[model samples]
Target: MPGWLEVVIRSFVSLVILFTVSKIFIRKSFTQVTYFEFVCGIVIGAILALGSINLQIPIAYPIMGLLIWGFIPYFMGWLSIKSETFRNLAYGRGIPIIKDGKVLEDNMKQQRYSSDELLKQLRSKNVFQVADVEFAVLETSGDISVLLKKDYQPVTPKDMGIKVAPIKEPETVIMDGKILDEPLATIGKNRQWLEMELEKIGVAIENVYLGQVDSYGQLTVDLFDDKLKVPSPQQLPLLLANIKKCQADLEAFALQTNNPTAKAMYEKNADEMMVVLEKVEPYLKQ
Candidate 1:
């Protein structure tokens, strides 16, 4: 083929290839655009532009070039997930829009998001009033996670009349074939304590998938031999009652404390209690 003709042909082929590859990766707009995907799009676009004019190379060379450009973004993304520093660098740090039930105007300015834009996202999520939000975090991907105020939240079954059992967060007994020490220390227990607790339920440490102390000071165990089971309605009431009583006691204690530390801790606990109650409402019976 003639030199000029070959170059033109390569150029046309490059255009077709670039479009096809970009469509494969970029998929949809307004979706979470990861750092890797964004970088891939740019690099592929640039390489295709280069390959179009470089007719001296074989077609195989251009195809290989496209592959390399494509995978660079994918590799970076995989790395980001494995490394916290890389993930932060790729996605950017979360910015706070609201703190302590107040809007941070300075943060909004820094993010270059106006009041209208913030309100638009909020309304899209059906959150109309700013007073309803306690803390709104602007995620790196431009998404917002809102923490709502107590009174503005939905009421739970506990609030209406249903009793709930105390269900504590399951402790990580083993992660990747290793026992976690941090949880052990937090609960003021050790390996010996865990082993004895397991024995009480006729389970071995290896046989137990997860075993932890519930908020009510009861050891809850999940055995590898058994399939998963949801708590009965009867059990839920106990858990709910435990949570409510603890919260009431905490609020009462906070009201009585004069120390700044106690006051701050109490307020923080109150906010968490409100959030939990709101989240569990759907499961509760009025």
Candidate 2:
């Protein structure tokens, strides 16, 4: 057999075996695939890849290694399910990163996670401050799960015993080359009314891929191949006003305290904000 042909044949067989073994042992869960499992997957793949390309290593050795590696996790998974102690030992339980609004700095140091990194994670979840989090845990997969205190959590209308407006589902008005008459009738609109709206957007009814009319009588239509990029709304005036107001407040606070560091910091930030505003004005004019 040719050398290239051997590689192709071995690669095909290795992939088939790898996928088969993976399907048997790997139970994917989106919550947290533990660090051990992730590393194991990578190592197993590397072993198979080496087995496929290297002519020196016997194919049987890699095949056996795959089985052994796969078996360990499969057995561990069973043991984890059957015993709580073993489960915790195999996949470490969540560690508290924050409790009672105070950051567990020592625990963070042990985990090698930085304060800035924690703040970034919190910000990603729409939490701007440490005081807002009641309990934050770091899962074994290196993900931060946060639970906010009741006061900080978003309050629903049901909590206040107040009724909210009924949810109105948008109905399809035009799809493909067909117009949906029933949905239009339910929203008290006809094809002629839909046509007029489509005309304003310079799109014809037959060319509309999808069209919807909401309960509020708002119409949204999409042409079959319209890919024009919409410009974002300009906000130079509002941003400039807010930045100036904040700078004034910071300067007043700095003067009252007479702290040299605070005064310098305020001056620096104010200067930077002015520079940003000046740069943004030309773009807004366009």
Candidate 3:
């Protein structure tokens, strides 16, 4: 074989072996990998490169190096799982860098994390002020986990004791102008329903670039034509408005009626409708 042919064959073999090993043994993302794992990756790539290009070196040597480098990490990972002490040693535990809105300089110094670096990480977390963070920990992955003070944190529905409906994942019924039958079925909707929705918006099936059915069962679509504007689904809002109007009419009737019994019935019905509206407002408004 020509020298170039030999190199190509070696590279192809090395690539297949590397890919197989990676799939079978290595699965962690770069950010999640430990220092030891990172070093092993560099060494493995160097060994493969030398093995592919350097014909003078025995192929068996590189193969042995690859096996050793790959299996040691896998074995260590297994051992780490079985033993807490070994796991902590292999993957260091999270260090508390901030407590009670105060920075722990000693811990930062130990980790060689400077003040500027700490501020930069906090800023990345969307926290500009150190005092706003009630507590913060430096994770083993080098990411900072921050907890904002109660006053500084954004208020949620739970905080206000308001009940909100749980949101479900939206189903993609159409993609690239093609109807996805499986996703349509997953959302408990058929092609006919989707077609009707498209028709309501004056859009054709082929003209739809993407279509998704949200948790509220509202079908939203993106069109291929940028200039064509599609109106949002108003079914929920319209239903809510109609219900409110009925409630108002009942109240008005209660005042207008001369008969005492009829007035009381109208007032009772209006009160009941008001309760129903409050219960469903959260879901419909969303």
lDDT of 3: 0.92
Clashes of each: 14, 0, 0
**Candidate 2 residue pairs in clash (backbone atoms < 3 Å):** none
Residue ranges of candidate 3 with Cα displaced over 4 Å: 58-64
Model 3 Cα lDDT, one tens digit per residue, 1-286: 7878878887888888888889988989888898899999999999999999999987788888898899889999999999999999889899999999999999999999999999999999899999999999999988899999999999999999998878999999999999999988987889999999888988999998999999888999999998999999998999999999999999999999999999999999999999999999888885
Better of 2 and 3 by lDDT: 3
Q: Model 1 Cα displacement at 16 (Å)?
A: 13
Report the C-alpha lDDT of model 2 over 97-179, residue by residue, as the tens digit. 99999999999999999988999999999999999899999887777999999999999978987544455799997888589
Give the winner by lDDT.
3
- Candidate number that wins on lDDT, 1 or 2: 2
Q: How accurate locally, in lDDT, is each candidate?
A: 0.73, 0.79, 0.92
Model 3 is weakest, by summed lDDT over 10 consecutive residues, at: 1-10
Worst 10 residues of 1 by lDDT: 228-237
lDDT for 135 (candidate 3): 96
TM-score between candidate 1 and the true structure: 0.44
